[model samples]
Target: MENLDGNIDLKIKEISQKLKELRLSRGYTSYETFAFENELNRVQYWRIESGQNITLKTLIKVLEIHQISLGEFFKDL
Candidate 1:
């Protein structure tokens, strides 16, 4: 896993915005609901969605829950 050392802050903002939009579009009422539906721990998912610093492994997992493959996740960036 890359340690998320470069552009970490920028990436956080970008990912946070995208996650917020995706959650709203999915009609998810809260982080708990979203996490449950996505098979993630609610607290961990909340942290990621809020752009708090996290491990790359967790980041990849969250992206997967969002149905974003590694390739697709980076193509736009």
Candidate 2:
């Protein structure tokens, strides 16, 4: 169970890192700017990038904003 928990945590971090990379690739140096431009809650977006818990709906919305499908997002992860 502990190992499973660790794996989950690692995956969360990976997702967070990928989100950050995507933001950077889009030329947004600040998460705040990205969030504001997208009309998302700044704090929530920050938490998502910080590896905090995120809902599937929110994740999907973000991916949509990035023009990336779930398959593409997870392909290299």
Candidate 3:
């Protein structure tokens, strides 16, 4: 069970990293610019991408901004 908890944490961090990569790949070189153009809170998005913490709603909002469905986001995971 403890291992399961650790695995969840690791996965969360991986998701965070992927979010950052996605932004970069989409030509948003700066996280701030991405957040601004997407009308998101810059600091909050930064936290999400930094693996600090994030909520499902926030994640959904980000994906929606990118026109990415949750299914597409998780397809390769």
Which predicted model would earn the best TM-score?
2
lDDT values, one for every candidate: 0.77, 0.99, 0.90
lDDT, candidate 1, 32-74, per-residue tens: 9888988889888888777887787987877776687877777
Candidate 3: tens digits of C-alpha lDDT, residues 1-77 = 99998988889998899899899989999999999989999999889998877888998998887789999999877
Displacement of the residue 12 alpha carbon in candidate 2, Å: 0.4
In candidate 3, which residue ranges exceed 4 Å CA deviation? none
Among these predicted structures, which one has the highest lDDT? 2
TM per prediction: 0.69, 0.99, 0.91
lDDT of 2 by residue, 1-77 (tens): 99999999999999999999999999999999999999999999999999998999999999999999999999999
Clashes of each: 0, 0, 0
Q: What is the clash count of model 3?
A: 0
Better of 1 and 2 by lDDT: 2
Ranking by TM-score: 2, 3, 1
Q: What's the C-alpha lDDT at position 13 in model 2? A: 98
Candidate 1 local accuracy as lDDT? 0.77
